[model samples]
Target: MTSFLPTDEEREFIEVAKGFALEKIRPIAREVEDNRIVNDKMVKELEELGFLSREMPEEWEGLELPLISQAQILQALSYGDLAVIQGLPGAGDAASFIRLQKDHPILSLHKEELIQSNKTIALLDLLEVANSQITIEKTENGWMIDGVSQPIRLASFADYVIVAAKDNEGVPVVLWVDIYQDQVKVDSGDYRLGLLASGTGKIIFDQVQISKQLALAEAEDAVKLMADTRNRIRVLQAAKQVGLMEAALDYATEYTAGRKAFGQEIAKFQGVSFRIADMAMETRIAAHLVWEAALAVDGGKNTAAGSSIRALYRAHRSLRFVTDSAVQLLGGHGYVQEYPVEKWMRDAQAQVTLYGRERELLIERGEQILSGAIGVTV
Candidate 1:
């Protein structure tokens, strides 16, 4: 079946985002992979190019494009490099969440910082330090935060920190604190198996004073917000992986066809050709679901049920196919860092864990949707 191709106008914008990633981000993919710094330079450039401004309102300095546009941008950017895409100078796609603030201080600070950032990035808010273990306390000056946050994406490079803390009422909420002046950020230097450019550091908010606008109306809402953000990230990231996996397949196909093996070119061998076929087919399906979810998001269906299904589609099913099959086609080279497949494989691992682990998210999302259950949103 013929897929829905993008409009010339849409493609034009995509090309702009693509060009930035290809020219600016691709060159640094290796270095970013080798280094711990989530260098914000490329991200800043992309932000300026309007890469992160997907679906944002023009009035708020965002493109207010569409959710599909947002997904496409991330997918293309990931093809060049996800680390650079995420370690963007400020924040992307975070404008809406920031504007949702009724009295959420953290969001207020974030919005202000984003303006200063020139819409360079969409930073991860520091809600639930260490995924809901650490706590933030309201203080006389403003609000005092205590505890360490793990995997602060581009923490060292982030212009602002979106913090999650509890007030005197024990209400879980978000706190937006700027790292440059208000708080101190520490680099963990702990490297991961993949997705390297992200600072992925430990951030400590030691008695940091947060103003009134930084706090969530209800602290308990932090968990919901986290779930929502993770879902969005997962679905969009899946779209990117689809692009990367296809590129890997192309490399395998071209290489195997041209290289001579036992009797003839390896592409003549069913072993080589079949693997490529599977990867290609699986990639198409994944792309569909990724787009479906993006459209769902565009349709305003950001429920856990929807998000979890999308997460399951991408993480457990689509991601698994892309990784395993890509490795199969590459033989030894797939496992070696010399090829980008190895990096792609490692990066794919993050999809499983991010948002919620597949099984956990599956059970939660499945049971609810199957049984027609719904969680109350604040």
Candidate 2:
């Protein structure tokens, strides 16, 4: 991330995470993807090791580490396998948004359980107008939520799903629904291009009755919460992008350096070396921006249209370029699954499309800048 190096504790944590990745995730990466399931034992180990509690409150048995530390942990874990990292037991950014709202009704009662159990909470972003398929209605006893969520990440495995919707007056509201409730139905599993092991799926609420205890009242600063959640998810995704680019670059570099062409190493060729140099430059820039975004978030700065968003968009493009170049450098070998380059490209594409597409971020940031709402440097 910036020029700054990791502290002793951070370095130790990264090493432990790397060891786990090598020992647990790397061996099972192919098996997990083929079976479309993550290793339960490995996930349990991460939970017990406190890797899942990075951003939680300490009072509830959370680690509450700095954002940069959390970013680094996610990045290191992602280098092992993006799908496995996604499927890990932890309160993702969605749950983090609810947890930050001190007055959340449901979270108030179940906060401790959430932290102690390391339960994953899926978020359905009904705020996306293009995907505003869900709606909520207030009932006499609780709330009746009816609609379908399209391919929520980890939906099949989530202990809870925090739904974002609008009320009668079009005010945004969030609902905390129990995944096992009778009214909740998982329509189908996703067979996407990548991240199949992350348990992506569609969920349908057929007149689902949410108990009052499970409903989170609209927070006073719901807008801010939405912005912060978006920024944080982008930051986390950016971290994953950094790992992907770095791994791909390293793989390609090593391959070119050792492979002989025209009676000489491929890396010795000016064209080959220059392409690798470009990939390295982009990867470095992406990594630095990710850390800068994390730092900005940790510093309590707004990053909706700022560094966090910029970093996310830049990383998306950079990762895509790096992975593509890596595959090209590997030539025929990269197109096959025998090597990791193909898989790295797949993972990079997934990250590029997830959360928000690179184009969407660019357009939003462009509009904001042109409107004078945010400076160009932001």
Candidate 3:
């Protein structure tokens, strides 16, 4: 019995975001990607528009919007260009951790730098329990972290990093590391696939010693904090993917409608028309799931975590399908740099990889249902 309609305030915010995205962000996407960084002017504009501080706390000079509102705003912005949106500065994924634990002492130590200096932070969440090259070992004072991490968004420019992982003994811990102070190495490797402007790179920790003072949470506290933060992150990421899907669907539909083939518009063909219909349907479904997940998280429902996993999985699948369809519909034009569909497709693939693996998310959701952790809903 929940309404999916936006409130008047939300509607106004979304419209502004949509307009700014299309007018400002879309035009410079190619330039940003080529330069591997968002220009200073665009970054300043985003900050002025409040898009950079949506998840941050008001005490920290942020809008601190709810996940539901943040999701919609992000969706509108991402519709212009997913790569540009992802490249934006400010807390990045670590904002979820800060939002969930605004009062943590460890976080307070860095609040001044983060808010005043506009320092960026990256989240290296190794709690996935998957195969990771990074290792965390317990030390007398705190822990010793070593090895290289998978490519993380915002890594290249991160002033600080929030590490969520387990020790060699499988004890959960969340640590806040000052990258420059700790002398951590950020490897900005050759990245050409997509999201080239996102500052994506690997963080190399060479037996770096972390003091106990930097531990944000440990043991059971860390586990709960990570789980809640992950739910928010998943829903937000899924919302962005839905925006990309919508962009692909709309672009393809418009192109097909105007382009002539065999003395008629290509939209006249059933094959083209049916594919566009499927793209539209898929985009709608992804948006609905993302909205549902955002609501569940905001409501503090037990199903929030499970719903987030499902939402992201579906968004990833639909994003890939929709982007590819856009490319196919445009025929040769789609593959060329002259059109945006090719870049969208590459960005979509990279987005999914950076967020989560499709099969893994599906399996996680299935496990949650079977264990009665979350109920099966229609």
Strongest candidate by TM-score? 3
- The local distance difference test score of each candidate is 0.61, 0.77, 0.91
Report the C-alpha lDDT of model 2 over 202-246, residue by residue, as the tens digit: 888889887766656564455557766767777877887787787
User: Pairs clashing in candidate 3?
Assistant: none
Q: After superposition, which runs of candidate 2 have C-alpha atoms over 4 Å from their true positions?
A: 1-3, 138-143, 211-213, 303-305, 370-376
Q: Which 10-residue window in model 1 sums to the lowest lDDT?
A: 121-130
TM-score of each: 0.80, 0.91, 0.98
Write model 1 residue lDDT over 139-241, tens digit each, in one string. Answer: 6656776666655455655556665555556666665666766466565665576666655566766667777765554544676766465556556666666
Per-residue CA lDDT of candidate 3, range 1-378, in tens? 977788999899999999998999999899999999999999999998888999998988889888888888989999999999999888999998899899999888778988888888999999875899999999999999999999999999898899999999999999988898555899999988999999999999989999998899999999999999999999999999988898889899999999998999999899999999999999999999999999999899988988899899999999999999999999999999989999999999899889988988887788778888777862
Model 1, residue 306: C-alpha shift (Å)? 1.6
TM-score of 2: 0.91
Report the lDDT of model 3 for residue 378.
Answer: 25
